[model samples]
Target chain A: MNVYLMIAVCSAVTLVPRILPLFVRTLDSLPKTIRKCMLLLPIAALGCLIFPLSLTDFSSSWYAGLVGVVAAFLSSYFRRPMIISIIISLVLTTLMLVLFP
Target chain B: MNVRRKSKAFQVLFAVAGECEFDENLIYSIAKHSHFWKNLHGKGIVLMQESTLCAKDGMKDGFPIFLGYFTTALAFGLLTRTSGLTLVQGVLISLTNYAGSGQFLMMNLYNAGSFLFEIALSVFFINSRYIFMSASLYPHLIDKKSVVKRILIGFGVTDENFAVSSLKGKMLPFPYMMGLIFTAYSGWVSGTFIGFVAGNFLPPVVQKASVITVYAMFASLLGGEVRRNAKALLVLLVSGLSNSVFILLVGIPTGFSFLLSMLLATAFACFIYTDEEVFGV
Candidate 1:
């Protein structure tokens, strides 16, 4: 694949979904079931992104990442803001890598 | 009780502020004694402050997300470089396609010499989630932004932006959204540039550790989401477990597997939560 053409193609594809909603009519009148199901998209999308994809680099420094996960969950569970949760997890991830290495 | 009236008061405050060209301290003093002040909650006050104090709040709000995106974007840039892409190409990818997973998958396909059609198909499916995100956010545009402005704003709606915007219950001002997007966009592009320029300087351990940021972010988001609702927890499990199955046993591509799992989990959630009997955990 020609690199520039591939990048353009990929970029266009991603933008299509995002830009489409601006042109389409509002979704307020959609079926109740569909709207309710749509609410789950963010959760499901987050879940889909989390598990197997996150499990990829585990064999090498899985413990470090795992430690980060625990810290992140605790931070969020305590109702901390997104930034605080991320900072806590990053710090924990770094600490785990150092301590375990 | 009346959310629309309160929101309208918010728009009027900002509009008058803009017309009069009020200073920050003046607006702050007025906001303290404003009638809407008594009726509105803490969120409304913050939205009022956003008209003048946006930069400060935006920076504060955008910083943590910036940190997360910066590290992952740096890793992405490094990946692009190693994949034989030029620094310019890597940066272009970040600028044009801010979707992190989609960009990663694109490079993977490129490296594998996958057919162009395959690349296009995977990219479309990977990013199809954005349609839902954008549609969900449309109702929150207070001013009924024009198509041109909507297109511009739509271009910047990544997962992180959607999360941030969705949580804010009011219509997002263009400037406020711009402030948020500005910080994130700069962090992402700069991080990518730095990664491309200094790929070899970072220790392998640090690079490896940075990969955890994505997982940590998602986990944290899920934690916040499920802390109150059992149904959300069920959806999370269904999506995560099903994704694992699809990837491990069924041998589906990561992008396709993720999209499929999302569909299955969302459909199941619709069924499970229909009656709202088990609404609360």
Candidate 2:
């Protein structure tokens, strides 16, 4: 396959759903049950995204990630802004990398 | 002309007009004191609304979770160049864009001359879940007025956008979706370009090391979620068990293992908590 062509086709195909809502008229009404089901999508996606990270064997990288996750949860629970939680987690992870190395 | 009668009539007219004016002022005063007016005066109200809406859309749909994806894309670009792809090829892949899984699969499938059918099947299988995801989000779309609009927006549906858009429901306006997608798309493309550039300037080890940043960010987000909902404990347990079984007993590829784990976990959760109230339904 021509890599460029493949990339183009793939990108085009992938972007379809992402950009579709921009033009569609929002549904004026939906059944209450369907609306309720929509809420589970995020939790499912998040679970998939995060589950792999914890299992990755990046040496001390896993520990660093663990620390970052703990810190983020605590900060978020305390009502700290996400940006603050993110920065603190990153800084802490980087420090762990340096200290352990 | 009876002067006394005329004076009495003028006095009655004045009294009626005064009463009407007083009632109008009283109604206006009550309206001004209402909660609707008070909310409008608060400085942070608009900002708070926008932020909450953005958070719901961006965070839920993985698209706005750009920082990790950006770092990973950059790493992929650098890796691709080392693996024999040209700089143009690397940039095009990220720019034209698909999710990381499909792209990674494509990279693995790339050879001197690969068959079209093989590649197509791989892409289809990897992306099949998106069909369900888009369907789930169909009801929440703000622009479902026409077939053309549906087809167009349907094209952008990925795990990230679907996740984000579904959670947002009606709260996510079209402009916000545009903003979220634009940011994510740009981040992926630019990150790839930077990765390609960095590939030329930096050592291989340094380029590889940058990947840890993506992992760090993912950990932060996932960790937070797990802590918040005790139910997530079941997800974690089911996922871990299935993954171990698939990897150890079945000896499947990591990608397949991860996918299987997700399916099993979701299925188990659905069965075990059938009576549990689903939030967005």
Candidate 3:
């Protein structure tokens, strides 16, 4: 694929959904079920992004990703700041790689 | 006060200050305490300060989001190099498509030799979630009547800013949304640039480990959701587990699998989730 054309196509696709609501009519009249279901999209997509994909992110050791995820979850559960959670995850992932390799 | 009185009061305040020992602060305080100033404020002329203050508040609330996007975009920058995309291409991708997972999936599918249509299809599906966010925020616009401004402000919606914006019970001023989105976007683009360039200097161990930062952000966001609604835990699990199944066992591609998994979880939510619980009404 020509990279520029591909980027254009991808960019246009992403931009439409976000900008569409402004042009269209109000969304308040949508069916309750559909609206309620839509509320689940961000949470569901976050889950889908993390599990299988995060599991495979590390090439050196699967355990690295696993450890990083655990650290991230633990910090996040405690309601520590977001940057703190990322740092904790990054540190642990790096530690795992250093020690195990 | 009417506009005439208001202007007269400002002139008197300035005149008094000019005649005095130049106590600008005293003149400002006098003008603020004047009945004319209070009357103008009462007539809804206090918007300029409040709007600027709201933008400042948005920036404060957006700081964490800025941090999250920075680290994640660093990872994205790292991935862009591995994906054989130029620095400009990577930056353009970040600028145009700020959706985190959708951007990653775009490059991944591209690297996998998927056609432009395939990339677009999957990206559209993954990013389609933003439509609902935009919809949810539409009613909160400070100036919703203008289609041109609506379209302009609509572009500022993102997952993080949406979360923040949705939490506000008041009307969302354009300046506030712009402040929030601007902070986060700068973090993303700058992080991508640094990550792409730093790839040459960073150790391999650290480079490999940075990928988890993006995942860590997603986890933190999910954590926020679960904290808000405990039942969201079920949706997260169902969506995540189903995604794994679809990709590993069923051999579905990432884009479709993600949407399918999301659908299954939303279906589950429909059965158990309450209107009050979901909408927090």
Model 1: pairs clashing at backbone N, Cα or C within 3 Å: none
Could you give candidate 1's per-residue lDDT for residues B44-96 as a string of tens digits?
44343233425455555566557767766766777677678899999999998
What value does DockQ give for candidate 2?
A: 0.31
Ranking, lDDT, top scorer first = 3, 1, 2
C-alpha lDDT values of all predictions: 0.64, 0.49, 0.68
What lDDT is reached at residue A10 by model 3? 82
Candidate 3 chain B has its poorest 10 consecutive residues by lDDT at B16-25
Q: Across residues B49-103, which tens digit of lDDT does each residue of candidate 3 receive?
A: 3233367877776666677677667878987876778999989888877777788
Per-residue accuracy of model 2 over B37-134 as CA lDDT, tens digit each: 22332443322123235433443343334654566567567657755788888887876664765665455445313455445444544554454455
* Candidate 2 A-chain TM-score: 0.65
Interface RMSD of 2: 11.4
Q: Identify the superior model by lDDT, candidate 2 or candidate 3.
A: 3
- Fnat of every candidate, listed in order: 0.64, 0.21, 0.69
User: What are the TM values for chain B, all candidates?
Assistant: 0.58, 0.52, 0.64
Q: Which candidate is the best by lDDT?
A: 3
How do the residues A38-78 of candidate 1 rate in per-residue lDDT, one tens digit apiece?
Answer: 44555566666667665555566667777887787778767
Error of 1 at B159 (Å): 6.8
lDDT accuracy of residue A43 in candidate 3: 60
